[model samples]
Target: MAISSYDISSANTELARRAGYVDAQWALPAINAVELRRLQRRSNLHATLSTSLWLGLTVIAGFAVVATAWSWWSIPSVAVYAALYGGASDSRWHEMGHGTAFRSRRANDVIYYLACFMLLRGPTIWRWSHYRHHTDTIIKGHDAEIAFQRPPSVARTLWRFTHLQGGSELLLRLVRHAGGRLDDEAKELVPAHERRRVVLESRIMIGVLLIAVIATVVLRSAIPVVLIGGSTFLGGWLVVFFGITQHAGLQENVFDHRLNTRTVMMNPVFRFLYLNMNFHVEHHMFPSVPYYSLPSLHGEISSQLAPALPSTWAAYRQIIGAFRRQQVDPNYEIPLELPKIEGDARPVEIGAESWMRGPSGEVIVGLETSFGLGELRKVDIGRHSVVVGRTESGSLFACEGWCTHAKVHLGEGAVIGEEIECPKHNARFDCRTGEATRKPAKDGLTTYPVTVSKGRVSVHLVGIDSVGS
Candidate 1:
């Protein structure tokens, strides 16, 4: 396959997909059942408390800015308000968008939509864009979220601190989307079925900003604007500050996130504000795990990965040094000190027509003892791959072996309760009915009937139905 030239801007080129950049092969470190369960556990109380605290602080900061207007106190007050609005919202946007932060889907949607408006992004537009980002992280000509391209520009990097370029581009795109004019890049990312929804969301957000503008005009004060949208620009500096540490001077077009992504050890306060996103490499590798569990996940896999930066200052120094060297030699890349991963095992490949078929045409997977309770296994029957899972309660189910959304083998993914999560994009499906229960996976898997008779597990090839039918 011919690899495409690196271009950070265009998404419709189709070169990345043709060259096999999209959904390219990646390595997975071996993990045991206990650690996987702990990492995948989502606590409603923890999520609610964390979200409530952030919201309460934002409300207080907004009120402080209003009360301290036209005074020296306003300077710090505005800064706080902006950090809450722009900086903290970035993390909220990310966590909530993943739907892993909150156990309740409604809660995640509520915060996700709110953060979308606050960040001046179209909800549907950004959702799909983010999906692509995870599917092709740091893959040149495919990953839309690449922060810094090759041949880094010093002046542009400095200007990003103000977020003027990013903010202006966001606003311009918002206006165009609101007017029902989708750009080529956006058209490629956002599905046609979601275009109308994007336009509607953009219009609604624009209308809200207009209301803030009207209030500012009526009251002859910038308070309403500051409270509404101006804070994003003022507070957006911290977003850039922390975001640059992620992949600024790292290698691109690589399948491994350890080389393309960075994990920085941030202060407690910064961790709180960024919602543990400082463990970015772990988050990308195991996206099924929620933000609250990222630290544990990092600890579990950190030995096989590179050592995290000691501090934000240390990360900046490295990034700056790399940027300087890149100015002279565009090929310069920061060498990562990663430990060797040991005993790494790949997924088991099943051949077509490998399993035995009974007289009734039912595929005989194995003995009842083959499937452990709450374990997922892959089986092949006459060129078809099937996923057979047993719940802790001893219920057996069979379905399509691969994730409907990404075609990734579900056998390698984690099983929580009766749901199996896709390892590639974290999309989930209910094992019993093969129903898609998560985003980035709208289509459900095809379920097959499984029966255990005489201590043998048998799967019926007939009567396969897609999820929700």
Candidate 2:
């Protein structure tokens, strides 16, 4: 009746096998390195052409509206044109905001500043807040965009604050928030220098508003002034709507990419309108890739992009349905604890050094358990643990690490077909794909790549086929 001691070597071998351990000796299909490079070049070319076209159209439309100002019908015509222009310009701004609009950094900055002026938004403020959003896409309390859903008190406060201002006040608050000052509150994401810049920019905008007001009063025509102001405010609303629709109600998962974001498939026309931003999941997976190239990238990695929202129209239906039910959950919390790593696991070096090397030369030393970028840290597990390894057929899979949902490892968790029933929460992920098959975890566990080199074994540190390739 003596309990046997845990064998570290056996455990390591098992983990390796479950992780889709590939043999270096076997000639796996080599990725078309040349084609990947060509695709990247093509992506860049497409981005440049698309951005240029949008910019040209915006300039043309702006001039056309201004030139037609003498006509009686020009006002409404201009309003319609302005709205379309705003949409197209905002899409360009989004592209430039991600630093993907142009190959050159300085060129992107110039384009961003111009687009910001056209959209009546401060470039510095938008960029800082946006950079933070990218860093913490769905992390509540950290991600500014998705952090609004919270305790009743906070939500009520925000709702009241935003509601008090019909539109002008909202614009003012947004300006103040972007400028590193949130309605007498200190800035959360804006840097000190940037905050000063925002204040200066706000003063300039105020001066512009005063001049417009004076001109309207002197001319005894307030209609045009209202149109301009309303356009700016409406532009902000559209931006907010776009942001909320993408990941507002989705479950949050700090370590799991699948639950962290949602994807929306749309027809080519709608895709053009959205600038391919509907590919939210793919964008989250590969943020460096430009928006214009997202559709193509999604096609290339279709298998990994499963469980998507099917289409933009369907996603819109879900949004509307949730709103009708008043069951929108904006702030879904993600577990912060790292998954337990057993055996001789170590930390993965994930800086420039790791990124510079090819995947074949890279070794996955640990698992990434955080939303933002950085080195992957090692986790210490106590007794029971889930071991993910490869099969004899060279297939990858997962069982249970320690189900944070259930509080037990695979030993206690029941294995049912391709899923491991968490002894604690009943949460499951297809160990093969590391995707959540069920919820209550609303998240999935960490996955590592296993490969055998000669007689020794190694885990892939660098992500394979994660980039444009």
Candidate 3:
């Protein structure tokens, strides 16, 4: 059936009401221009320094472990050191994976590859899957980051398997998934090129494993490998445990922003161990923000987000209780509906048209048919208030009708240099490149390309391919 415009509006309104929000207040926790710029600068500094410290500690710990390995008594001590090093290195690697640890893309790539090599994981595969997770968090059937679903009978069987081996079962699952023979349905989640790259990297990781095995044989001592390897295993498991605790039992509601994810405010120890991942909801809201800056970003807008989720400990307790009751009920489902916004008669542009504007007298840039929304099966067009402005150098930039990070419009944000700052969360995005310049936003703003011909400015309704392209 051909869908009518009225059906779209009615669906949107119903969705908004179910989400417990008013259309007028859809834009939230407004902030002024100056604060946004300040926050961006602070986030940049924190990300850089934190990443460096973690890397330096990892190197030092590795040397210490090797030096202590001379004595049999030091085997367990070396194990402890190896675990600490692995965990700490993984923290820095996580930041690099997000492209927030280093300003240079090449440097981030180097760190990411090295970290993945040590962890026996695939960097390209991790990036493809993680990027998708950020774009479609809590989106069931589409998001692969969520654990695989199982029927009640299968769940019971899996529980029995886990009970038999305890930690070994978890390790077996990782091996099976990373064995480079993913099923057709599982393969679709990753880009084809990335899947190939992952298979290649997995081969390289196998080489590393072989070298470790050879070393054990040469030394005529399986004890060192067992001790050191056990530590590495424990460290990797801790990282996985942190992820499980963060999202397990959280509602997977694609359209309902409030119930979709959990929020955690961590103590300093947990923050250090998990690398500030405790702020999962804030991270979800702003994926581009570096991990180091998440805690500060969360603090700035805590009041605005408090209504959606409870304290971190509350979430932890809830998950524990659920686990005890069912032993293996991984599905925490919630109904979702898109929110609504009430405003003046303003044209809203999507994807590329978002970047263009008409001549001085005409604010609208493109006709309705310009945007390629044929593939979007369900869409709603309402009065959207967008912040459109030109920089001092005459470059035009368009952001969300509201800041996805803090629900404030870009109109209230200030343009500094080449970036626009989000007042409420101190988030910032490069106007020229449309890349996020600060934490909390993993994905950038949907940017549109602008063009001018014979004094008439036109915004393209296509996606931006690059900064200038």
| Model 3 misplacement above 4 A | 1-45, 70-76, 147-186, 221-231, 307-315, 326-469
Per residue, candidate 1 scores C-alpha lDDT tens digits across 337-416 of: 66655654243222222367677777787888867666677775545677787766778888888888876888766676
Cα displacement (Å) at residue 259, model 2: 1.5
Residues 1-469, model 3: lDDT tens digits:
2211212133433453355432223123322233333333324455556666666665565566566666784666565555555455566667677655454555766877776655545566556556546654544444546652221243543453232343353334335555767444336445564566656666666566566678789988654454333445545545544565556554643433344556666567667767787777666555445566676666765555544334556665765565544445444342323233223212112222343334442245443333221111011113444444455355665444456554555554545546665533445687766787754455677665655565544444453333231
Better of 1 and 2 by lDDT: 1
The per-model lDDT (C-alpha) reads 0.81, 0.48, 0.50
Overlapping backbone residue pairs in candidate 2 total: 15
- Displacement of residue 349 (Cα, Å) in model 1 is 12
Name the 10 consecutive residues with the lowest summed lDDT in model 3: 372-381
After superposition, candidate 2 runs with Cα above 4 Å error: 1-48, 59-79, 147-170, 174-186, 218-228, 235-237, 324-469
Q: Write the number of the candidate with greater TM-score, choosing between 1 and 3.
A: 1
| Cα-based TM-score, every candidate | 0.90, 0.54, 0.60
Global fold similarity of model 3 (TM-score): 0.60
- lDDT for residue 304 in candidate 3, whole number 0-100: 52
